[model samples]
Target chain A: MKQLRHFFDLVARTLFVLSSTPFRMKEFSRQLYFVANGSLPIVLFCVGFAAIVTILEASFHMKLVIQNDSMVPGFAALLILRELGPVVTALLLTSRVGAGFTAEVGLMKTTEQIDALRMLGIDPVQYLVVPRLIATIVGTFLLALLASMTCLLGAMFVTDIHLGYSPAMFLSSMRVFVDFQDLLLAGLKGAVFGAVIPLVSCHFGFLCEEGAEGVGKATTQSVVVSSVSIIVLDFILSYVFSYV
Target chain B: MIEYRGLVKRFGAKTILNGLNLRIEEGEIVFVLGTSGTGKSVLLKNTVGLFRPDAGEIWIQGREVSKLSEHDYLEVRKVCGMVFQHPALFDSMTVYENVAFGLRRFEELSESEIADRVKESLARVHLKGIEDKKPPQISYGMQKRVSLARTVALNPRILLFDEPTTGLDPVTTRAVNHLIFELSRKMKTTSIVVSHDMECALEIADRIVLLDKGSIVTQGTPSEIKKSEIPLVRGFLEEVLA
Candidate 1:
């Protein structure tokens, strides 16, 4: 519970600094490049496989239960846009980007660079967290949009070959189950999940103890907490999106 | 001038700083000498509002600063610059960029003016022609000097050093100690150094303060501290005496 309060405090402080401080475009661009471009191929490759799995599994289950795989495309598209694209991408990011943020910031703290920053009259929140926060939010949103497109295409391709459905047939059926709004909601989920990553990462970082073991523990805790936060936040967002 | 009045800092049940009180005059170099975990660094941090005291007040230039907001603390930090135990140079930036970071933030200097000041600051620390080198690319001693250069660029009224010579070799240690003395004496800044090196403390400090178990054990000029009979003081002095 104390940890939760500390997390919220970090969020509050980061937001306050974000609003009041001038934006650092150079650092923001650097972080965005790392978040989006650096992780792009891995995110796309993994999500593509997830899409194939979703298509195949949905076909098999529907055929056994209902004796027809006719709705597989629509169901697969619905699942991809609403959850798989954003959540899978985010969990991947939580491991890749979130862990990186934790280790980087944790090292800074252990090395006293954070104190050095404060001594220079530059707030660490303003110098480190703010740029990464902005970059991650923007990058994750874009990645979600791209991941959704890639997953839908992969699912379509799988339905045409494995499920014995044509591409046109898959698209026609998918239109009935999901729409553009699902994609936007998925992007929103990505943005929120992105915001959680740096906050959790940097919070553990600022509170990091000394030594390699301390940094190792902080990194593990940061990853665990961020991944869990993304899942919990996903459920909340999904529940809210259900109405929309 | 800076003063700490009955300062207390606790982490959970462990009190790191207990009723610690000290006064530092303007344009004086004070060495806070203590063993590990003795709250020497904590006192320095609390002075700048990096760590707030659980009880008591900190006054900088007659302004009560322990309660200042982080934004308000910038004014205090502008007057008090700290060099950490580590080099603490930003890994992502070159030495030139690191030194100019503070100038770009607090001063409205043009790019050329900032570059000139950065060069001058680095030169003050006896570093020249390493401007484009990143922290990792340079030697550790050089990195430490660059960190000092970064802090010195701001021309702060008070300078704080946290074990500035901990990991260096004897030659580099003497060089850094001399650099600290030179910077303080030449700049005429009030300097507080947290260190465990009694030998260096005696050489550079105008006043040496010995701390044990989070409180002052003895504080005096070099001759007075050298004459003290306290066991802890004797223990610290054994190496210097040898």
Candidate 2:
């Protein structure tokens, strides 16, 4: 519970600093490059495979239960747009970007660079946490949109080649079960999960102790907490969006 | 001017700084000498609000600073500069950016003026032409010099150096010691150097405070410290003598 409060405290401080300070375009671009560009290929690779597996498994289950896999494309499209794309991309980012933030900031704390920054009269929150939080939020949202498109294309290709359904047939089925709101909410989930990650990671980073072991522990904790947060938030957003 | 009265710092169950009290006057060169884990670095950190004291008052220039907000601490931070134990240069920035970083924030110098000061500050540390290089490309000693250059560029009234000469060679160590003395005397800079360099402490420090178990073991002028029979002082002096 105390740890949860600390996480909110970090978010509050970073938000306060962000409002007061001028936007750091250079630092934001740098962090965006690290969070978005650096992790893009890996996230795309994993989510494409995940989407394919979803289609195959859904088809198999439909055939087993009711002896008709004709609705596989619609069901797969619904699942991918609603859950697989945003949640998988966010979890991947939690591991890639969130873990990196924890270790990097934890190292800065241990090496006294954070203190050096404070001594220079630069708020570490403004300089370190703000840029990262904004960047991850922006990057994750964009990545979610792109990952959803890629997943749909991959699903279409697999349905055509493996399941003997044409791309046109797949799209017709997909449009029936999924709409633009699902994609928008997926992007919204991406943005919200994005906000949680750097705040949680940097909170652990600031609490890091003195040694490689401390940094290692902080990294593990950040990744676990971020991944878990993404899952819990996925459920919450799903419930909230159900009403939407 | 900095004063720590009844300062205490703890980490979990263990106390690092135990009811420590000390005062540093303006333009004085105070060397805090201590064995490892004696809270030397913690003292330096507390002075700058990096680590707030668990208990007691830290008055800097007659203002109680231990309880200041981080935003409030900025006003005090502007007057002080600290060189950390590590080079502590930002990994992503070049040496020039690192040096000019504080100046751009603290002062409104023009770009050319910042460039000139960055060159001059780096040159003072006998570091030339490495301005464009990142810290990782340079040797550790050179990075330390760059770190010092970054601190001194702002012309801070109080300079807190944590192990300022730890990794430098003999020549650079002497040069740093000379620079400390020169800055204190010429600029009227108040300096608190936390170090294990007894020889340099004896040579250049106006006063030396030996700390043990998070408390002051002894403190005096170098000559007075030289004459003291405290085992810790004698032990430190014996190393220099040998």
State the lDDT of candidate 1 residue by residue for A64-179, as single tens digits: 99999998899889999889999999999988998899899999999989988887777788889999999999999999879988999999898888878999998899889987
TM-score of 1: 0.96
Assess the local accuracy of residue B57 in candidate 2 as a C-alpha lDDT between 0 and 100: 92
True contacts kept of each: 0.86, 0.89
DockQ metric for all predictions: 0.80, 0.81
Question: Model 1: which residue pairs collide?
Answer: none
Using alpha carbons, what is the TM-score of model 2?
A: 0.95
Q: How well does candidate 2 score on lDDT at residue A153?
A: 91
Report the lDDT of model 2 for residue A178. 91
Best by DockQ: 2
Model 2 residue B59 distance off true place after TM-score fit, in angstroms? 2.9
User: Candidate 1 chain B: worst 10 consecutive residues by lDDT?
Assistant: B41-50
